[model samples]
Target: MSTCKNCQNQLTPDSDYCNKCGARVIRNRLTFGNLFTHFSEEFLNYDNKLLQTFIALFAKPEAVIRSYISGTRKKYVNVISYFAIAITIAGIQLFILQRFFPEAMSMDSISTEATKEFNLKILEFIQDYQSIAMMLNVPIYALVSKLVFIGEKKFKYNYTEHLVIYMYLLAQLSAIGTVIIVTAAAFDLSLGTTSLILSPIQFIYIGYALKRIFNLDWTNFIMRTLIFICALIAFTVIASIVTGVLMYFNGDFQKMIEAQKAANEAARTVKDTIN
Candidate 1:
């Protein structure tokens, strides 16, 4: 027999709650069975439901959200869980693709002296401020959504709702990006005309998806689309500038390599003539 500390009620050894006051009772012994029971209670008890929700998320995102928001949440994946799984999958895909496809990992592949320098500098910057890239998507989406929805009454969504949209958008983009990366890796293809042309179209899809998800009207939807396009342009400009700065340094390196090659060729020519 045990007693509750708060209510002073008599409790059985196996009892978790006080009969009198309903306060929780703590067990003194921490055995393997008790640990397993606690673990089971927290995470493992809902394994089947979690798996079911995950499947629904990939199959029908809108339906999953609709179900969850309408109080049918038990049968679907929670928004946080969906976001976590999507982000984890995206991260893993990026890692694998980058490892296997060096060209795909690069922003540009012209391989000019300037481009080489820029690439090295960008790599160094990524290594130094890795966390910045991880946090960029949320803030970028938030800004775009806020700007697009400004002064609009019917199209307005709260921050949390916007966050859900952002997650969905991220998941879609990550899936597309993964497919592109994997294909490039398998075929050893360059980021040529196909990528350049399709990339803008992908943003169009994102804008359309956002409009549908938020139930925005055509005017508001167009504004959101423009915001996305602007954001893309801004990102491109920043990347180009960074690459240019790095290329300046790379030019010196390229000169040394060129000079070494020329010297070796001249030496070989002299030896051949003497022989």
Candidate 2:
């Protein structure tokens, strides 16, 4: 009898695959070439689930989301794993930018010194804890989506389902956004400009995905999309108010004012020298 290395299943000597586990019978020791071949088969093959999932997300999102939600998971990468991959990619992109294109991360050329300081502080926090920030956004997005789609009786997805929905949506966006941001950075684009370019596409793709998932008519889709945008705007306003209050209490506003005065003094000195 031969043994399957993967599952310890008994096998006939002539069998090429394990009957129980379906792993291919490997008769040779592990080597670099074989490892590369295995990786190509798993991730780069034509039938690989990751590639299928990525293409299907844009081609037929409803089928992918519905199948996973209905417990048919083998055909596509699950939400958690896909999201983790996206977050990892995003982290790598941040590292590349900070390492090779540090100036792209700054906003000083486009803003006053005080504004630049505030923006840099925000940027630093985001860069330092981006994964946490992304994880936090998922739940908030799920809540907003659930509230918006509460009236759908036929496809009544619960809060957790909404979480799954946004997880997939955000992961896809992150993947695409990572590529765009990296390419833009290579060409010396500012992070702010790249974000401005991406934000609309992100919103449009989210609306497109939701429309397909719900099979909504154009009118209903537009209405719901606008409502979603308004809800997000309200949330942003509230968060900004709270953040401003916190900044004031922490004396950040005083620092900003001082920075602004120093910047003004420097600008006036330069002007006098020019005169």
Candidate 3:
């Protein structure tokens, strides 16, 4: 009797596969040549899949999401793995900026005391918790998506499906955002001004992606896109306020405000003496 190497199942000499485990009956031994060849093949295959995913994500995000939902698995990385890796890359970028590009962003130059305090508190909160903040966005995106994009058949994406879509979308966006941050730091660009300049690009990318995903015509597309944008703005404002309030009660925000106010008063006293 011949045996299957994979499961050690008894088989006829003529059998091409193991009956018990459905394993392919391979004849080749584990040679160094085969090991190298297999390693290269797997590595290249993974690299290719990653590239295809990013291309589809940037060039036609809706199509990639749709394809994944339709059971196509080979062309892209799984959403969970993609999101984890993307967030880690983003965290690296944030660390680099915070450590090496300290002067890239500062509210210290602003004159208004309240504005300075509020902005500094917010900035510190964001800097400290940006990774967690972005991760928190996944569920919010899924929620908003299900709310805004409800329809039948081709237009309908269920909540879990929408979660998958958002995971991929957010991963790609996080990578893009990290790149934008690095570029701004390199050029000594104002993050506020850069955000303003990039807002339309963000809207356009999202609008086109959603339009394709929803299969909407121009009028409905514009209406739905605007509504989604408004929803996002509202959600962001609420989240920011909640974060600020929590930090305030914890005494973190109070410390920032007091420090800023003391600095401002000292500056005022110095100016008065000079006058």
Which residue segments of model 2 deviate by more than 4 Å? 1-26, 108-114, 272-275
Q: Could you tell me every candidate's TM-score relative to the true structure?
A: 0.55, 0.90, 0.75
lDDT of 1 by residue, 98-207 (tens): 67765655545544543554455555565455345544665567666666666667545666666666665565565566577567767766544235645776676666
Instruction: Score each candidate by Cα lDDT.
Output: 0.63, 0.90, 0.78
The lDDT leader among the candidates is 2
Worst 10 residues of 2 by lDDT: 106-115
Local accuracy of candidate 3 as per-residue lDDT tens digits, 1-275: 88887888899888877999998786789899988986777555656666678888888787789888998877787787788889898879868877888776665544266666677666676788877877778889888878888753566878989898888877887787778877987898655545665677766776777777777889988888787888988898998789788978999787877887798899999999999
lDDT tens digits by residue: candidate 2, 1-275: 88998999999989999989999999989999999999999999979999999999999999889999999999999999999999999999999999998878866545665578778777888998999988988998888888889898778999999999999999999999999988998999989888888999999899999999999999989988998998888887887788888989999878888888888999999999999
Query: Which residue ranges in model 1 land beyond 4 Å of their true spot?
Result: 1-72, 98-104, 110-116, 123-132, 191-198, 217-220, 231-275
By the lDDT metric, which is better: model 2 or model 3?
2
Q: How would you order the candidates by lDDT, starting with the best?
A: 2, 3, 1
Best by TM-score: 2
